[model samples]
Target: MDINNALKADPAPLGLAGFGLTTFLLSFVNAGILSGSAVNVVMPLAFAYGGFAQLLTGAFEMRRGNTFGFTAFTSYGSFWFFYAFLVIFNDLKIISIPGKALGIALILWGLFTLYMWSGTFRLNLALFLTFLFLWLAFIVLGFGSYYSIIELTRLGGIFGFLTAFFAVYTSFGIVNNSLKPGTIPLGPAILK
Candidate 1:
């Protein structure tokens, strides 16, 4: 049988799954947000969070022809790799520049995701919209922190959590849709 035939309608390949899964894992290692600045502190946190898991996920997502999977998994996976090698890049000794930079990047990416969110309804729609607006809102919050709006960063973290929650919840759709054999409403990910 063709490999494609075995899947349940373009469900994320293991790689894509791994990418999102690994990203989810990293959030735990970092201490009290980006409030601290120490290689000893940050590097270990990154190493624990960043590893081959993301690479595996990205490579598989690429094989599955998931542009979002490819882009997200690969980019974030690389971020961890680079994050680990701060020895050369020196990601520390800075005042949370990465957060502000991440905000900028996320804002740009959110614009694209918003476009994706506009696609015809499908099993993936909810996941995508949840991901899009949450990140867009998250970016705004992150940037706000740079301007001393600490509440913004807190709010950003909430959106970020929303992003994570949906990512995890969306995984359930794979199981639910597969079980239902053909029915799962579309666009709920944004709301639920």
Candidate 2:
């Protein structure tokens, strides 16, 4: 699961898949982010899992030769890594500010991705709309007060489940050499 390793030797496609899967994993946390009252509640564990995974993945992403890979993985990784430090010690101030920060990030990422992908890919209207909803929803979710964003948080969690169950389970399984996802399998397995 070294994101920087570039397994297939094609970083763009593989890196994107990597980024997409990693992003998917974060959705569960994002769901938690949107549903839970404060970032502090989730920060303790989020830092280690999110931070270390990204740190390793980002390095491999760089090795994969993705210009977008390193920054995306590492920056997002660093966000969690530093936050882990703040969380373990009960520094609530950092948690207080991150919701808004994450919100802004969603807005920017959505905008950039929409504009970037809209014109390039032969994306169907349905696909385009899905992306639109996905990106805009988070951008708007960011607007919720950190304390009272249950519905919007639920929306984020829905996306998280979709992406996780559909998107990343296989890749992560490949990286880890285990089928710990239990009920969420991407396809029929050789074992079965």
Candidate 2: C-alpha RMSD to true structure equals 8.3
Model 1 TM-score on a 0 to 1 scale:
0.58
In order, the Cα lDDT scores of the candidates are 0.52, 0.50
Instruction: Work out the TM-score per prediction.
Output: 0.58, 0.50
Q: What's the TM for model 2? A: 0.50
Candidate 2: tens digits of C-alpha lDDT, residues 1-192: 784353754322332244345445556555664443355545644555456666666787776675455665576567566545654554645344466665665566557646633532342332233344445545545554243466676676566455334324334434443324344333342221
Clashing pairs in 2: 3-57, 3-60, 3-61, 4-59, 4-60, 4-61, 5-60
Where in model 1 is the C-alpha error above 4 Å? 1-51, 79-125, 176-192
